[model samples]
Target: MDLRFRDPQTRIGNLADEPILVVCPRCSRRATVTPERLTCAGCALVRVRSAPNYSVWNGPVDPFFREPLWLRADCCGGHTLWAFHERHLDLLERFIAAKLRERGLGDDPGLTLVARLPAWITAAKHRDEVLRTIAKLRATLS
Candidate 1:
């Protein structure tokens, strides 16, 4: 007896085992999420999907099968900004130093001094401003 039933509109609960793919509404990039909450990789915005078994499916899964978090490329900038959050200040400073070095401002005493500032100071400020400062510093060096 072939019990296989296929319905295009009908989503079978058994298929729920499959990872949900959440696409970013803004950028259309894929994101990872816990079973209950969907996170946009591009934006990092968290949303709850209207589905059961939300907890069981939450975690990193194969990108292909996972739902895409439709987000704009600009959204990913939050991740960069969040790096300086108080909780991750040390890591953020390291990242800033590395970026400064990449832009050839590593030797600038002023740039190095700014890089040593507490991550909390950076986090309290706007990331775009920081980026602009770096760019201006680079231009001065050149």
Candidate 2:
């Protein structure tokens, strides 16, 4: 089966009225639905409404950290926006670790450590961590 067919490119505006199933770019999870705005079940990040065409997902990447990472994306006037949050890094790490464990994949302690930091700090320390993770996840499912 073509994975792309599983992950359809949905218009951002459609999320306002009901929950829409979407593939998470950070973790390769399926059937993640956004009931209101985009909120990841895999992470504690919350995407909040902003201007008509803009929205922001701001929160800590992990529970161990206080600083929050903010992501801004163009909504294309669809009444919604696309963004990611690294808030609750510890939670994210635990989630990922559990998934990896389930898959029989060894944990990368360094990566887990990095995931425990705020998004900004992680981006600065490892510039491509988030992007790379997203890309890798997309590739795996797609």
Candidate 3:
């Protein structure tokens, strides 16, 4: 099947609404993080967000609590890749897998996450390696 995509106009902020999978600081196991709370299954630790205000996060860390994300892998010449959650990772997988990707047809295309993706993430030469890294990250969930 042809991998074609018409940009969805999704922003990274919109993705944070989904659960953020973070490495539990207490148990070194997977933890679930939301805008309001963080809960770890292995450690039975629960913490509420003390400071709700957030600066934009675009790295391998949770936005609200600033904890390292659980689903992370090394790729693309030692660059660490990560995702907030399954949905976030799925979005990245689909975006990277697409053979023909179009920019958003919105007021400002630059506002979309796809437009803001790093050059290494979007470059054709790195496609296979990046997809492999994404697969490695996805494997962490299961």
lDDT score for residue 129 of model 1:
55
TM-score of 2: 0.23
TM-score of each: 0.24, 0.23, 0.93
Candidate 3 clashing pairs, residues 3+ apart or interchain: none
Model 1 TM-score relative to the real fold: 0.24
The numbered model that scores best in lDDT is: 3
On lDDT, who's better, 2 or 3?
A: 3
lDDT, candidate 1, 27-128, per-residue tens: 666554444666676777777756453333222232233442221122124332221112222233344433233222234434332344445435535445
What are the root-mean-square deviations of the candidates from the true structure over C-alphas? 21.5, 16.8, 1.3
Candidate with better TM-score, 2 vs 3: 3
Model 2 alpha-carbon miss at residue 11, Å: 15
User: For candidate 3, what's the RMSD?
Assistant: 1.3
Runs off by more than 4 Å, candidate 1: 1-11, 32-35, 49-142
lDDT, candidate 2, equals 0.32
lDDT of each: 0.37, 0.32, 0.86
Write the residue-wise lDDT of candidate 3 on 33-68 in tens digits.
998998999989999988667654888888888889
